[model samples]
Target chain A: MVFTTIVNCVRARGPDEFWRKRRIFKLAAHYIGRRRNCYTVAIKIVHRALVYATKGRQLRKQDITELRNARIIAGCEQHGLNFNDLREGLLRCNIMLNRKTLADLAAWEPYSFKALTDIAKQKTKEDGFGSVKDLQAPVGVITRGMSK
Target chain B: MSVLKRVQQWATFARIWHVYDATWQNPFQSAELLKKYLMGIHKPIYHPMNDCGDHVIVINSLDIALPGNEWAKRVYFHHTGYPGGATWTLAWELHRKDPTMILKKAVYNSMDGNLQRRYTMERLHIFPDGNVPPELMGNVSNQIRQIRPMPKRLDHYTKEEVEKFPKIIDYPKDYILR
Candidate 1:
């Protein structure tokens, strides 16, 4: 049947507002899930909602990576290279450390980042890339990287 | 003319498959405990019929720890019963060939013998690489924050990996001949 029909049939007199709504939708999905024509739609809706809820759980992590990256970028700027240049330094040198660990070092110790920058600059010069910044500008913007 | 514009979503990371990095130190001790965490075993919402395990992607499988001399002294036994058909091998030999197998076998033993276990095991992946392709898609990005308390893991070492480990083993400078 239609949503209105399921809603009317499944309505409850429960005191809890959230529980009442959950019961209504669940009953509706249950009804639809049993019907050949509507079962796919109902399951899709449920899975969609579950994934949406799960997605919310990942927000905290994204925020933190941004914060850490910001700190590292700032550290790089103080060394006369913007975040862009420093990343070029890494790419030019083919450094393998992940963003999290690299950022942590930048935030925790200044000299270490300087050391990495110095090493990267030397490597870039040896590679004939002229200033690691010219090389790194593109790498930092790579939006889709594989292997987390 | 009607046209359908396709939308492409680019993901930045991969799903958090339960990837475990095993050291030669502790590879297989509390494998049962890890199974519970990997499978989401302690949930009221856990449907025994459903594949409810979270994705885990592990690295450093070769670094897991094990107790005693199981790698050397303890022999894995098998037999076909022809003339001298019995066979046995030490864990040390297996270490060089397949380090991940030590822990994989432990996990297999801990999992229930059922269809659900099969699917859950599929989600539990292990790799030796330092980085993997991101499993997250679109503007969605997930960061890994592994401050969670680890459940006990199974022993990973042969007695040699354990006894030789610096964390457990110690010697004075004079003890070294060099």
Candidate 2:
């Protein structure tokens, strides 16, 4: 009656698990002390470091925005107009230049920036915004509103 | 432009100190000015969600003037989120306690109630007087004109300049002037 018996027991994880852990440890080889040699610690440290790398992507966006603002501010100063006035003028004239392009023109190309500012000033004047009374339209350039 | 040049351009950002004077200008107007700089609305790159603002250095805050009777009428309220914890202070009183509080509050209220507001406020630097620290002075690249012209003090006038000033009315010879 008891000639054959079958037993089921829990077994240890296979080599696949060990290899997964070994990969993380290998990537963390430069880590100092036990973090480099200990598989458990290396896994935790390397995962946390990866998290920071992910967050760094978002940080880069914020930095770019700040940089664009700086360039625009410098351009506005050069043209004797604040950022708001320039945008308002451009909007009235239906000029749809993006910030990156505007910043580029502001930094590297003064004549083009001045031309844009002149158009903006002319349009802002035509729109009846009273604050931009000081802006003088550049001679010999016809704007969108002027052609009609 | 090439992709690499465009990418390089994006990495460069300048930090500049913008000066604002509060003397004889309404707190709300000054606040609006500060808000524009704070929110980076003055820049072409300004976005509601981005922190692209420049540094705003406000001086002569003690001399800030308010339109109408707002100095006495405006009241700042606060609560501690408990029973009988509400507190109210007059604008003049608050300004007296801290000369920078009124402008700071005005600017705070003007911005949208979002997470970036606190970070924007950090860029605002308020000074009660005109004397800014030497270290901060070097960072200032441009000065924004005040909404109202600063009234010239009598001491600033030279003897020749005072003599040239037109007389409004002739005083009686017998009257002694203080």
Candidate 3:
């Protein structure tokens, strides 16, 4: 309930001392060397690792987005279409596709992507988009006017 | 896996044979297009570590077009590791020696220099002309569209179509014949 002397009172931290260090040790369990066993060392390393983990979460999303963009660009180049033109044309035609789905279509569904590119080209040609002024209109893309 | 699932898996992983007609197409541009198929980057399930590349049969490599003066200016350099072994061959000269070399080199250089490149290239069968072996041709189920439209030469136009084309003005009957 009370320390008999001032020295003993100052020396005592709490009954939960071992548990406090144990938590840090657990986080560093996989770490090699004294870092995994020593409480002070483990705590410092764990703090740095936690910071990296936090930053990595954001980086992972950016990496995926960049990869999807690269894949889409590669697909566009193959069909001789500008990446921006494809996106603009699709938007004008009311085809709402995000990068993730577009990337998937570009990769797995080659024929579908081909049709999309054709549609994009047709839309760009119809609208007389500046970038596509020289682009030849793709044939056989049946739009509403054609259907009627 | 069950029989249907097993078959589906096989179909998913099956190597597709793609035919590309390189007539009047730029080798560098064609290389960029073909690299995706060769590396299987077109597959939704593509992973750099996974081998999902397809087989591409490039035909009419001899007809590849070089933009500007690339035929004369482009050089293929090689060295034999001797004191004076460095040799630079003009594109046209190289093309004359090997009709398929330019396209092959284009495809090879287009891909990232990695351990997988050489092996991936082996899957690409290029012919100088559309003379693929029947066995190889039989495997082809897909034809990659040419990047640029082939231009029709004046001589190749049909007489009736040429005559039907709208004329802006009739040359004066008395206009001095060149």
Off by over 4 Å in 1: A1-148, B1-16, B78-86, B129-178
How accurate locally is residue B31 in candidate 2, as Cα lDDT from 0 to 100? Answer: 85
Q: By DockQ, highest first, what's the ranking?
A: 3, 2, 1
lDDT winner: 3
Residue-level error in angstroms, candidate 1, position A74: 41
Please give the clash total of every predicted structure, in order: 59, 0, 1
What is the TM-score (0 to 1) of chain A in model 2?
A: 0.75
Q: Global CA lDDT of candidate 3, please?
A: 0.89
The total of clashing pairs for model 1 equals: 59
Q: Which sections of candidate 2 miss by over 4 Å?
A: A1-113, A119-148, B1-12, B174-178
Which candidate, 1 or 2, has the higher lDDT?
A: 2
Instruction: List pairs with backbone clashes in candidate 3.
Output: A107-B42
Model 3 C-alpha lDDT per residue in residues A54-87, reported as the tens digit of each score: 9999999997887788778767877878789999
By the TM-score metric, which is better: model 2 or model 3?
3
Summarize candidate 2's per-residue lDDT along B5-98 as a digit string, tens digits.
Answer: 7875664335567999888888888887778776766654455565568899999999989889898998999899999999999998999999
Proportion of native contacts kept per candidate? 0.00, 0.07, 0.24
C-alpha RMSD in Å of predicted model 2 compared with the true structure? 11.8
Model 2 lDDT tens row, A1-148: 4525343221223357766776787789889999999887888999998898899899988877777877787678666777788888887777889888888887677679889887777776677674677667567767777789
